[model samples]
Target: MPEYKQFPLADTAEGLTEAEILGWRIKPGDEVTVNQIVVEIETAKAAVELPIPWAGVVTELLVEPGQTVEVGAPILTVDVDPGGAAAPAPVTNGSAPADPQAAEEEMKPLVGYGSKTVVAKRRPRKTATATPEPVSEPVPEPEPMASVHTVSAPRGGYVPLAKPPVRKLAKELGVDLYDLTGTAEGGVITREDVRRAAEPASAAPAAPVAAGARERRVPVKGVRKATAQAMVASAFTAPHVTEFLTVDVTPMMELRQRLKTSPAFAGVKLTPLAFAAKAVCLAARRTPDVNAVWDDSGATAEIVYKDYVHLGIAAATPRGLVVPKIRDADAMSLVDLARALEDLTSTARDGKTTPEAMLGGTFTITNVGVFGVDTGTPIINPGESAILAVGAIRDMPWVVDGELAVRKVMQLSLSFDHRVIDGQQGSQFLADVGALLADPAVAITF
Candidate 1:
């Protein structure tokens, strides 16, 4: 049979150029079945497991873990036919009569790959002629055991008190398996239990206690690299102007409470963010100038007007800030908008948010309210003309209907590229958004 070779990294998705090999599920010389997870690839969006398309014995592992390979790169090679498929011959070591059938049975392929061959060499054993001094004291009683396979009595048989994933988490966190009291069903270790035990309160922080220590080095790649380049370009090119307005959003809060019980908004969490997003969408309709982007690339240099509103929600996660957009947000109802917000936030948190989800935002909203911040002028995300910063809603006494009353107030900060949107247009946009938040019913009038 002719041997056919597979190329490295094959395009798994449209427009996908490169992917990093996260790990391998199987090793070389293993007989792989169709649909078996061979390797994992981290794409621009998420980490995905790639299955073997054909069943065969893994002949070679072409790539190593943590290596970023381009699309169509061959990661592994499989031998469809391992020649005659005859078992290796058995031998007698002069101890007793050998069972050839038993030896042949052992050599048969039970699963992927058989045992690998490694040459063994004998070395001279070291025996101290003179007794040496004690190296250290005996291990303490409270010390945890070094191995999981060697469980003592009453612990029961090989069921291993920890679930596979939980055990993985414990290993990653350097948590001692013996010290953790497994709360999982039937004495299995759970993820939550492991996580709690790994917390700073349970154990001291991992960093050395020395003062002015060196910082750890982490390679800046993927989303972080892309974000840095975009931010630098935007900050340098756009002449930014920031404007802030404090508004009494007591009415919007009341509206949210009332809508929570309405039949139109069942199974949805009504949040101030939803109200703010809706207000921004509605306001953009009146002042399209704020909704437009500056495209001076053309000869005449004109402001490009986009009739549709792609509302960008700036979310801060472990991987820094990511702005994922909701297309045609103006066309969606309050309930649908809330659902979309939840989806986008979840995706961003999981690091599965796509670049497409982050592109083509005309206007953006950053809810600094969650972080308990008063207000700050947010930088405009690349390709977007304006960004709205929504600050924390705090209860403060304000003049309402000619009377002093405790009301919920928040600061709305708008930063726009002055070159694209003039101060007059930007101010009008902010005023309209403020008006909607003041009385949500005003949005229906527009």
Candidate 2:
């Protein structure tokens, strides 16, 4: 006789209560092995693959794809001994089996299950109708509803058909996909469609909607939900003071182009961000308070200063905004820093950033210039004391040697925790970063 085992949801970090089943790898009756991936689940942080711990034949799947299951809930059942003859069906309605061994076998322990004894509780079966009622002859069939105004994706609720990246973009922009009609094949929504829908009514070039169109709601979950909670907490708990600086980055840009042609930086793709990151690390040496955190939870309030810089780059991924860190960034050369930034951003954009990579960040930098924005005061990461926002670099007229000349200019916005850093220290640190970009030779003085 084969014993049935129930698999419960595994515990996750941050006390995530539930996870949505993204997909199932195996079906009922299929043989599975130990450590085989059984299902993919999306929690509040990342998508994780859950593996089966015991070899068995799948008996039942208690949850369907796209359905959210709570932690510790039984998700699937399996029969352990497939070769053995099938045991008699267990009695329904909470009745125990007649044979003691059969009853004990049914209560066998499974992975993620507690020591509590398992009991089978079945719902009452519905009675089957034996005879069919006769219908009136020549009954007229109602006309099918028009396709013009009908939503064909699904009935009762609309689930937009989009890849994870597209969905992430829509969530960040606060766009509702249920109201927009997809133009892609098979009614799949594309990223462009979501961006268009997010635009204001007057600026958007889309066609007008019907008068009675209904509104749609999308629940915030996964990375977006976690980011929201952290931001709210950080904003209320920390007193932020932001400082801005605009500098001519022509020297830095020229140096970048020269480095690109050099054999020393052959494979590294150097950007202005790498220069800014290097500058931040160099400036921190003079003003250590900007790199420290304020700890007030303990009995004695103190400033915790870090000796090394674990630089964080704010990256927007298909999963949401994630800040993956580069370990010991202050010790790296310019070329090495560029390479690390390249790999970090690429990995984050692909949704492959691990939880460990996002931990232990000492300072952060956000490149709003990529989105073509001038500059904005960025919020500090939860554990970090300050965040630097880099704006778009463009050609602007500037006075050089008492003569007007075109120079590459960029804006830098620094937001720091007021508890850890005062206005004097914050302004000095911002000035040092700007001075480095204005002339890379200033790094030698550090």
Candidate 3:
């Protein structure tokens, strides 16, 4: 008679379809209070902790950790009204419990146990004339199971001792767990065992379009999977046009060196990327087309231009490439931009960037310069029109006023969606950004 409540996996971000259960805070039979942290999940954007909406006793965890569940699917269940009525009888073939003792005896053991040998007991020979049919003819053994999900030999098709996600991973990698013994405690097969079994096959020549090979086959599931899908879709959907510019930035470099000792910029990790970020914001004012989106879903093709800039800084982490935005970046002072960039990047590297922080980016800047690369033709993010790739700032010989001199120089590459921004607008925007980086003092005129 207990009222059961199922907790579904909710969409943590816009267009997020699924998430992998990272861990559980409570188990079956554990008491839980409302607003208690129940589970941690990793979505496409970031990892998030979910809380219980109602107080209850954890009745069951429908899904195990490492299993990816779709949005709106129930991951756990609870008995919300456990004290209001009698405990529900054990469900066995739709029949009710025969007695209170039987119900009490069967109520426990909610957790799974490993399969044991099912031995058949024989009865003593009776005083009958018929010779009791000898306990012979032998008990027929089970056949060899073709799949890894089933245990082989004496256990027949009985379930083996492996976690659900481990089993899932084994099957995907084509590893036969029945033949390979697990190295885990109690001989429970793990993901490492499965991958080890698949090692020989992984070394074989990969197919033309295979996603993995060369000694290891990793299943793309989390951030890597999401990034690949997004980039592919953006490349195919948007017409990308990349432009480049090289500028002598001696003045800007001198200013940066001077600002390091300034009282206003004290305690701030002012970086060259921050200067590029500020430049992008100021340049967008003259070329709003670079900040617009192509809205083809409407009745007719329309361009939606934004008044403010949600500047995105592309950060590479252990997970994947994530672009977290600083909202209203154009309104911030140079010092404020420096502080925001520092915090945003550190949070991203720590894998703590929230999904909301990655959304609604109007423009993106990727510092390839950090890797000592010159420049790259970056692909535009789907929702935004432009992306700027900052190249390595190096000392090179330059001609200043028809006189040769050694100065600091940097390269900038801008990729934009041609459908929204014309060639002229894109060129002007790129030039303006280069001008700002070459001369930080030019920002006062804007």
Best by TM-score: 2
How many pairs collide in each candidate, listed in order?
A: 14, 0, 0
Model 2 stretches with alpha carbons more than 4 Å out:
12-15, 85-214
Cα lDDT of model 2 by residue, 214-280, tens digit: 4556577777888899899889988999999999999999999999999999988899999999999
The total number of steric clashes, by the backbone 3 Å criterion, in model 3 comes to: 0
The per-model lDDT (C-alpha) reads 0.71, 0.80, 0.79
Encode model 1's per-residue lDDT on 249-312: one tens digit a residue. Answer: 9889998999999998898977899989999888888888888888878787777889999999
When summed lDDT is taken over every stretch of 10 residues in candidate 3, the lowest stretch is 117-126
Best-fitting candidate, measured by lDDT? 2
RMSD of each: 12.5, 7.9, 10.5
Q: Could you tell me the TM-score of candidate 3?
A: 0.73
lDDT minimum window of 10 residues, candidate 1: 116-125
Which portions of model 1 show Cα errors greater than 4 Å? Answer: 1-4, 10-19, 25-40, 43-58, 70-74, 78-213, 296-300
Order of all candidates by TM-score, from best down to worst? 2, 3, 1
lDDT of 2 at 162: 66
Q: What is the TM-score of each candidate against the true structure?
A: 0.67, 0.74, 0.73
Tell me how far the alpha carbon of residue 211 in candidate 3 is from the true structure, in angstroms, after superposition.
16
